[model samples]
Target: MNGRLLTGYVLRRLGQALVVLWGAITLSFLIVQLTPGDPARLMVMGGEGGDAGAANEEQLAQVRADMGLDQPVILQYLGYLGRVVTFDWGTAYSQQRQSVTDVIGQGIGSTLELGAVSLLLMTALGIVFALGSVLLPTAWLRSAFQGVTVIGIAVPSFVLAIALLQIFSFQLGWFPAFGADGLRSVLLPSITIALLGAGTLSQVFARSIREVSAEGYVEVARARGLSPAQVVLRHVLRNASLPVYTIVGMLVGGIVSGAAIIETIFGRPGIGNLYVEAVSARDFPLIQALIVLTGGIYVLVTLIVDLSYPLIDPRVVSPAARRTR
Candidate 1:
């Protein structure tokens, strides 16, 4: 694509991302509000109706009024939207008085670290396994790789995490069972995330490779005396990468959102854990921030991937270029 067209495409994707983010924000707000009972009351009572919650209706009314919970839902939503647009995420309701940004920041950094490790591992392992599955001469080896891929897809991440924990942490004592202490602490959890992503991608990559292999260019490359490895790497994989990239792009969200479950299973401190705590405590500001943040990340990753198609295959660029013209 020409520079002008590429720029327009990127701008269009960014605009769409903004729309999706707004929808996610609005949906999150509505869901949080629709829940039974007053959020302010729940925040104060810690989601419990016990002796400690002896405050009468009058006192609860006063609490709600103080928090602007007395405002109409639409007005509250509009006001909340304004604050969000202005980057004022408000303060945490359940924890020590801290800005919601600061609260999320703490966990976000750790989550990013974990995500970075997992993504790298997933991409590398996915490409390697996919290549091996198609390129290996032995049928049994191909079958074994396929079997592994099936297992990866069939086993839920949480279940895989627990199994990993039991075998590696409990019986073998290879790594720490919990806590994001250092590189060692991240290994098993990262593997858990990688396995899930890689498994799915391997299938995509293999299918793409198989489809590309049957194309005339692959035959032409072979006819030109390109070595098997040369044809596979230079032609086959390049063409196959479009689909692989698409899957990787989509998996970015899965890795981030799935962190909640993996983090919980591994007892790692991250946004997932924070999310769990925020929901349990009815922390509206924190929950809202997380929802927006997560949605933004997913949209951004997808946008990047969509724009990247042209770079991988000239054929993809032509379609977009034609549409623009």
Candidate 2:
């Protein structure tokens, strides 16, 4: 790609990321605001409900004012957007007025650890499975890899989590069933999240590899006396990886969503677990912050994928393509 084309692509993707983040912020705010539950009531009741028939109007009003629930929705949303831009997520209602950032901070380490491990595992498994399906000598071996990919795609993360828990934790006692403590505790959940990603990614990746193999460049590379492995690895794999990168971008969102369920299932203390509690208690600020954080992450990952494309294969975003645009 021309330098100008790469620069233009980065700028374009940044603008799009901003749009996605703003949309996520707005939607999350609306969902929390428009939902039927009242955070003020939950607050006054100390995260639980009491005799709703016995509460006085004055008490209700105080709670609403205290939590800024009395403000107009538009004003609240604007103010929220402002605070988020300033990195002020405010306090968590369900956590007794603790800073939402701090609350998230406490668990972010665990989440990052889990996320990192999950990503590595997913990439490893996806490539191995995809390559095996494409290059394995036996049809049975290829079919087995393809079969497992299908199962991975078909099964939900929570269901897989439960099954793994029963088999590895409960039956074999090979790993802990729940909690986020040490490396061993992280293994099962990471695998659970990875499997979810690997399943979808492997199928797409395998197809991409197969398609790239048929491209003229691969034939040219082989004609130039390059070995089969060299033709596949240096030529085919690099070109084929564009789609896989897109899948990796999408997998971040899947991992985030799956982590929520997986975290709750495994009793791991992460942002996912906190999100569950915030939703259950109708903690507006916490919920909005988590949504923005997760959405922002997804957007950032996709942006990275978009930018990395030209670096990996300049032909994908050539000057000619930019000129046509």
Candidate 3:
């Protein structure tokens, strides 16, 4: 739990994440390659394959050669790994003029802008709701808050987004229906993203906190003249919160992957939109690249959360961390 130990633990976990990412990328490439699609034919549809039904064997072979598809899968994977380490993601086959890194880089930023802000919103609101549901003095207030949380959980993001658009954009004409521009544009989308996250997290955290509060440590703290707020903040909160932090990290990963629908509804130029297009056009390389990228993101977030564990509880320690401590 000491600073030195935490740092070492984080570093080790990062190394493991790297390995997991490599495996994910390799698997994604294998799946995409083995499946049927012709990026070259898709790119130059009218000129190359207009008369034909699809890319012929010769066309597929030529396309493969042009894109270095002739190289062994292992070799290609190694090359991809090397490029990824250097942040040099290859070019998209369809958008030959634009670099794949550039496209994904922009999309990642856009997605992050939406995801991070929404995450913050969700966590704060969820925690507040959890506190209200469990800690609030009045049963009626608790029931009302719980009802709202249930409603939030039931409403799907896209449906919510559309409804908000209708209410705020169509009816009120307050913000653009589909864009990530000023605060106006993000308002509805952010709300929709936060609602689902908060609804789920609040339910989880409220239950956790209630259980922790009833534990012996909480009773002991209360016995020792520590106020309810003090005990909850000092002992109960930390214990109940440790798991939530992990869930938060997983939620971040979930948001990154899960916002595709919301992003599509809002016409946000995020990775989700690209994912949709790639699937539609059967852009194997792009799809493979996205899969790898998303996996890497998930692994990275999970590692961060793992490293955060001991910090929240002084007792927990990993091997590298123990040595450092």
Candidate 4:
């Protein structure tokens, strides 16, 4: 809680983040090398369906040299680490003279927008579902709320996306089937992503609320003649919300990773769509960069959530901080 403790906690998390990043980079590099066939040849062939015999030895050798694939593996890895740190993600092998950064930039905005909208919807739906399950007067109403959450969790996102498209876009005609033209186009895909997270959070949150409601303080508040709403708002909500923060942080990473499938299903342009293209084309550089980008996002969100715990619940203490005392 003090300045010194906060500094040490932050430093520790940063160290852990660096380790995770290193692992992601190493994994990406290994994936490129372990794939069948020569990367240089693949690059020269211009990805899948290109004429394999069209590129001669000279072109293959040049591609290898240009990619630093001619160097020793250890040296190449070291150089790659340096490039990643410097944000020089190299060129897209499948695209003519386009940098990997530029290729990613083209779709990053769409992904971010989708992620943001989905996150908000996830939060709102989760809170509503959690509160309804716990606070609704009728037992049947509570069961219905719980049933919705179960369905949301059980259904595969891709299946749900297709079903939504069929009903909303094809039959009802309330929204577009696909594309990222306007806010309307965003609605279906965002809902597809949000439902999964909301379902998960609602279950976790409802459980937390039940546990918090039984605490002695809550009993005391209710004993003081405060109404149900007053007791819940004043005594139960804040403590119950602590677990929700952690769950929400984890959901952020899931949202990012899930974007690929959801984007592909909805015919939306996003990092996920770009990732599929990169893989299909055997564009190692672009694929490597995207892997790191997603990994970094996961690590960053987790670190932020860890740091926020002390602010949310001042009673929280890191093991390191506790040991120091």
Candidate 5:
């Protein structure tokens, strides 16, 4: 019965995410089109609008028409929708001459690189801290650990990025703060992003562990004269860990988005920083495209987390006929 409900939940979530994707696409189109600047104009040049050039009105109008800018908005949307369905995104507005997929392809790897590396670091750190906090002896130490985690949650990523840059790049002369070429390049930025996740996940795991420790069955372990390690590793941590596991994917979405600000601060060529540049120039298609991609990714990640819930708790997979597929 629980299996049936879990299957149903996954399908429903997929359907809902599809709806959200559609809405996001539609809203993005409307917002970009309604905005004041000409997307084509924004796309033609680069570097802070230094040159509008001396193109005549005829040339400008011709450029617009050639790019299908003169077409009716609804018709254009239909055309764009058709291409998107076929997975054939055309050229980006900013990189007007470059294919949409090409532009995304060019930048996505870097963004993904940052996000993936950061998540790995964060997961390892968060889980370790959480487990340690649970098993550690001192109440004062636990309080201190939790306080540090809260501070991590409060500070902005950009601020962290700048400080790290100053320390590592300027003062220490350790890791090169910018270009993400290799493993060494990834270290500082990954650490910065991971810090945020570490704080949030650590608190979550700590709270869950503390709660699980208080459950009636945990007392059974205590009464049985089990060693503290045996009680925690064999009982408390397992149950406590289940809920915290769901947070892993949700945080992936955040790490990906947060990487943008962090990447830009350090002048990395990751997609997030590219997006920052794209938005400032009002590169509508690029902005819209990135938004769609990011939103889709977040939706997919959340859906995975939701489906994984039953693995955490059978109660999440209620046996109600209404809940089941």
Candidate 6:
């Protein structure tokens, strides 16, 4: 791609990312605001054994004022946007007035670690399955690989987590059943999340490989006296793998979302568990911040994937840029 086109492509992708982030932030704010039950009242009464009379008017009003709930919706939204931009996510009333950043910080590391491990496993599994489906010697073997991918896609994360826990933890005592203590603690959850993504990616990759294998260039390569493995490794693999990049980027969001359920089931500490706590306690700031964080991650990953196209294949160009030209 020309320098001018590349610059325009980057700028266009960035603009789209900003718009998506803004929409996500705005939607999260609106949903939290519209949800039944007052956060301030919830905060005041959460510790009072569910008694409505536990929190008086002054207490509720004070809590509301402290939480900026007394301000107009527009003002609150503007204030929220400012906070998000500044990375000042405010305090968590549900956590004894702890700073939101500190609260999230305590768990973000574990979540990122889980996500990173899961991503690696997912990518490796996808490539293996794709290659097996296409390169295996027998039809039944290829069919078996395809069947496994279908099962992986069909199983929900929680159900998979439970089954794995039963077999690996309870039955064999192979790994810890719960908690984020060490590497062993991460294995089951990561595997559970990886299987889901690997299933979709392998299917897409297998199709791409089949299409690429039919191209005339592939035929010429085979006729050039190169071995089957050499032609596949040198030519088919690179081209067939291009589409897999986009699938990997999209899978990140699923990994994070799945983390919530997997973490809860496995008793792991992460943003997913924090999210559940924030919602249960009506901690608006924490809830909104987590939503924005998840959305930002999705936007960033997809943006990176889009920008990488030209690097992966020079012939790749933005369709939007092409139209403009």
Q: In each prediction, how many residue pairs overlap at the backbone (N, C-alpha, C within less than 3 A)?
A: 0, 0, 0, 0, 1, 0
User: How well does model 2 score by local distance difference test?
Assistant: 0.83
Higher-ranked by lDDT: 1 or 6 = 6
Show the lowest summed lDDT stretch of 10 residues, model 3.
43-52
Per-residue CA lDDT of candidate 5, range 177-220, in tens?
78878888888999999998898898898888889889999999
Worst 10 residues of 1 by lDDT: 46-55
State TM-scores per candidate: 0.90, 0.91, 0.84, 0.93, 0.86, 0.93
Q: What is the C-alpha lDDT profile of model 4 across 141-184, one tens digit per residue? A: 99999989997799999899999999999999999998999999
Query: Residue 164, candidate 3: how far off, in angstroms?
Result: 1.7
Given candidate 4, what's the lDDT at residue 278? 83
lDDT tens readout by residue for model 1, 179-213:
99999999999999999999999999989898998
1 versus 4: better lDDT goes to: 4
lDDT (Cα, tens digit) per residue for candidate 6, span 254-325? 998988999999999999999888877777778888999999999999999988878887556656635753
Cα lDDT, model 6, residue 93: 71
Writing each residue's lDDT as its tens digit, candidate 3 over 220-313 gives 8899998767877788887898767877877876687667888899888888888887666555656777888888778877887877777676
Question: Which sections of candidate 2 miss by over 4 Å?
Answer: 37-39, 42-63, 66-68, 223-227, 319-325
Off by over 4 Å in 6: 47-49, 318-325
Superposed on all Cα atoms, the candidates' RMSDs to the truth, in angstroms, are 2.7, 2.5, 3.8, 2.3, 3.2, 2.2
Q: Where's the lowest-lDDT run of ten residues in candidate 4? A: 316-325
Clashing pairs in 2: none
Error of 6 at 55 (Å): 2.2
Residue 6 lDDT in candidate 3: 64
- Please rank every candidate by TM-score, starting with the best: 4, 6, 2, 1, 5, 3
Question: Model 3 TM-score?
Answer: 0.84
User: Which residue runs of candidate 3 sit more than 4 Å off their true CA positions?
Assistant: 1-12, 37-62, 86-88, 225-227, 318-325
Query: Where does model 4 exceed 4 Å of error?
Result: 46-48, 318-325
